[model samples]
Target: MIDPLQIDDILASGGALSKYFSSYEERGDQIEMSKLVLQGYEENMAEVIEAGTGIGKSFGYLVPAILHYEETREKTVVATSTITLQKQLVDKDLPTLMKALGKDIPFALLMGRSNYLCLRRYLDNTVSQSIFASDPTSEDGKLATWVRTTEDGILDELQALPRGVLKSDIASDFELCLGQKCPNFSRCFFFKSRKKAESAGIIVTNHHLLFLDAKKRCDNDEDYTEKALLPPYNRLIIDECHNMDKNATSLFTQVFSYYGFLWEYRKLVAVKHGANASNLITLAAGIVKGKENEALDVIKELESAEKIINNLNSILVMSLSGSEQRVDKSNYSFFLSKYSASLIAIKQSLDKITSLLNSIIGKTAFSDEDSYIQQGINSAICTFEGYSSFISEFLNIKEFKDKVYYLTREKNKNREEVQLKISPLEVSDILRESIFEKLDSVICLSATLKVDREFDFFRNQVGLDQREILSGCFESPFDYKKNLLLLIDNGKVLYKNNQESLYFDHAAEKIISAVRASGGGALVLFTSYKMLEYVSSKALSELAGFNILIQNGELSRSQLLKRFRDDKDSVLFATQSFWEGVDIPGDSLRLLILTKLPYPQVNEPLFKSRCEKLESEGESSFMMLSVPSMIMKLKQGLGRLIRSKDDKGVAYILDGRMNRSREYFLSQLPPCNCPDDFLDESLERRIEDFLY
Candidate 1:
């Protein structure tokens, strides 16, 4: 086993990290956590850690991880929740660590295959492409030029193009890829990336891919395991570990969306002189005898399948009758009973289409001249099989009582349609069987994984066995009492049970006043889009003189944040995605207004089903699940207030429920000043004086 003292010395005040990072400050908490991670790996046990913000948690794990890899030459996989952090590790942290250590350690950044460009698809689109060649400035022309000069063929490398252009036109589609049989197989970007990852000592990836890999491993099929996306690894480290349950649940769940069906359908049917599945089928038929009849039959079956899908969708929309409430299953349980016959018909049509496509491919034996066309047919078959499998899961409701099934509406090119979706109520068993049991050692780390200084909530949610796993919590090095203030609303008038509009108006008034008192540098967070819209409209008109940036249709998250940071006196209004992963420090952000307590929307089918299952198991769903979950979210929001030692801010909770849940919420927060009457004129004046 590696010496714990050696690890500590490396992370000490005079260690390599401090020497490398000019702004780095040595913290005892970071060192302690590093030692614990090393100890866990040595003992071959799982570890759960909640390291507070500014704890330098990345280095704490990376140092130990690198040392372990070098000493044992074992592959260590690090999975993060968001692309922002994943890039940070690959582009910043790992490079800096390697530089400090002065060692040539091989590391690779692995993303989903869909993220890379497919050479075959790209060439097909640009081979003497006449679609937009007449105009050099057209989107298609520019895309064709980019395809020629690009090296890595990763979507992110092309910043000059629109987001979905590559995904739609050139990105690798698993169903369409010909693998080793393709002429471009020697230059495939996805395979090249996989090869690099296989040989690297450390692999960096996201939570979605890692969980998907685990799910495949749990199938216990040797063929599937051998052909798995990722190389073999026994040690794993998951950052933002709180999202693991949700990520795992999503991976295990299945859904068949209207847009997905339409996407596959468009690929097969020729549209506006474009090459499609039918043309490819005909091309293949010239090379193989009797294949023409089989191809024609498959095309006819697909056309019929498309008609049935459209008919079923029309019936579903008509039954809903533009009632938005029908989208939430908790509000409308009659959907299944009313449309059972149509659902069955749709399922049968899908099965028939899948069988027809499979049979066509099974009978074809084309020469090299038809290899490309054969690849397209194989791709269509794979898509059909996926559709059939998803439909089977949706129709077989009896197999999964803990699963929630629902229909939701979406718009595509001004046309509205409904989609069927399903999710597991709890993924504890899935995680245990798929991920935990297959790993020799696992480390779960996050900033908000603990509530009331306990890991029970996190452990239960993540399916971590207490007897086998070690857990710890580390406080932030920053002095929160000196730099932060948490305030709860004492004004009962804010929660008068008025109409939502009236309540929003009242909330808007408070928000405006707070932003004005702080002279801007405020982040107003809302729980829902409706509330955000109402508050944004009211505040925009009321606070006209201030620079207001709202997170909506106008700008992206990164763009909005950039504008917020550039202007010192700016108020940014945002919802869900802004609750966490936002970092604003110093005087640029002096106030944070939480419109309401962060609570799981009970109407959401997944949350409702999970609560019901917990109740059936003789558990207090509110205490065991709801409260802890909200507390963690509250902690995440609060952590956003004080990012550094010099940063000072005031966090205002506008909800009146904070009074009843004061003990539970406040105990999880930083130093707070809860006055008896914050709405009083004198109290308001006092708050202004204190904050300003």
Candidate 2:
């Protein structure tokens, strides 16, 4: 029976791992920050933790939450950005804390449904020959046979098999899940995981699932959805709080694909085969036509309309590609236009059907809600509810509608060859009310929270009210000045400062110079995938005898990390995913080259919307979305360099914006009392000097 004061003593004593891990200087400010966070959780108030480098932030907060959970027997939901931290907590950190405290609490890992194998999909492939055409006796089919005999249904277990044979061959979307009606429901791994999670005292999940649940709850009041799986809990602790807005935005946006539509259309045709074959086939043809596709069954007209849609989709993909500058040219504009038009037509068709259904609804003498009339109401409502809003948004972008067209690939059975439009934008207010407002307590914790020394930018974008915001800063346990050389070059060759080609070559050269100087333990980070690819292609043959790991160079994160660790002379060129969540302790990573400050693409649909909203409030969108996000990411990248006390490294900001920008990113960044001469332009040798 330990007392609260003793608990405080344990924290002060630095627990068991303290001796092995780096020591944190217990400053008054840091202690106060830790206290505030603990109090906030106790009082059920929203809190933001901006723990800077050297502040033992992870354990500082983890200790209190663990203590609270132990006392009350309540669950503490810890959400992290990467699988690595999730593994760390489950395997390392939590165990150390538990052993120190002599307490064993229940915990469970909750992940997306896709992470688990679909028993139904596996069973169907085994039982049905008509469903999948290839001979079951063949090599591929023989492998499927082996899977049925020895399938554990865990994603990690499945990975042991040949790569393409696993996820590539088998998957069942939730909509197609058939629930209890499915024969394999009793043996589904997803359900088994959910059952365990529902009962566990402490649940660990990623931010993606949390946001997915919140959005799914608002959109569909269904139990099998993301929100329904969440066990009733009083408090929520978001670990990678910086990514909340970006993840939430992605959750709310709906995207329709040409391949998906075509597949569904074919399925519908297949189901109504034989006597109905000719008419259905004709209707499907019309559905492929641009103007003819107005009605779901308008065969000739749909065929003509689909042609027009395909034409527009092609143009839009090309035009939008020019603006966003990512490799995958997902013609989002084409989808928006065609879907909007289709929605209008769908509504009209459904409206006519509704009139007929209403006439026969009660006349059929069906009283149950699932009856014909109720069924009519149920299905038709999905089409009519948001029809007007989608149409209005579409009409507003009428000018870009002309550019919408299809990008088709030749003989690609695996991929949806027909490129479709999608709306990639932020959905803040919706997420805030749906998830944040409903939760009793919301805790957003991260190493990088305060950008330019203020949480207002992140707080606003995440839809948290300023008055409700309670923030704290826990300084890290590492010595930043001694371990890190903060290098900010005032070079004119930056992405925003010059032509695309000019900046690429300039950035590539700088990266080469850093790699050569460091003898290669470096990570060249890029905001855009295109830039990463460009720099990678240029560096590939140029930086020979050095292991160059590029983002898209057929290497998984784990693979790249292994390669980098194996070779002292190696550099990893990475983009969005690698910008953060990378942990290279010691001298494995000695330098970080940030190609540009990460800012939300202005052309992205959600970005445009947020920008307008900010403009209405007389605030700069760049400050709200751009600067804060960049600062958090920059801090994350910087933190990756000096993972432990012994690790020494340099972080180079190639983009002059970090130096020129009016202290927005710097003020919010981790306070590193860098040497006065470190940022000197004349001290060209300083970077090399620090490396040694």
Q: Which candidate should be chosen as best, given lDDT against the real structure?
A: 1
RMSD of each: 3.5, 7.8
lDDT of each: 0.76, 0.61
Clashes of each: 0, 47
Least lDDT summed over 10 consecutive residues: which range in candidate 1?
Answer: 322-331
lDDT, candidate 1, 583-618, per-residue tens:
888788889989888888765667767787789989
Q: Candidate 2: TM-score?
A: 0.75
- Cα error, residue 120 of model 2, in Å, equals 2.6
Structure candidate 1, residue pairs in collision? none
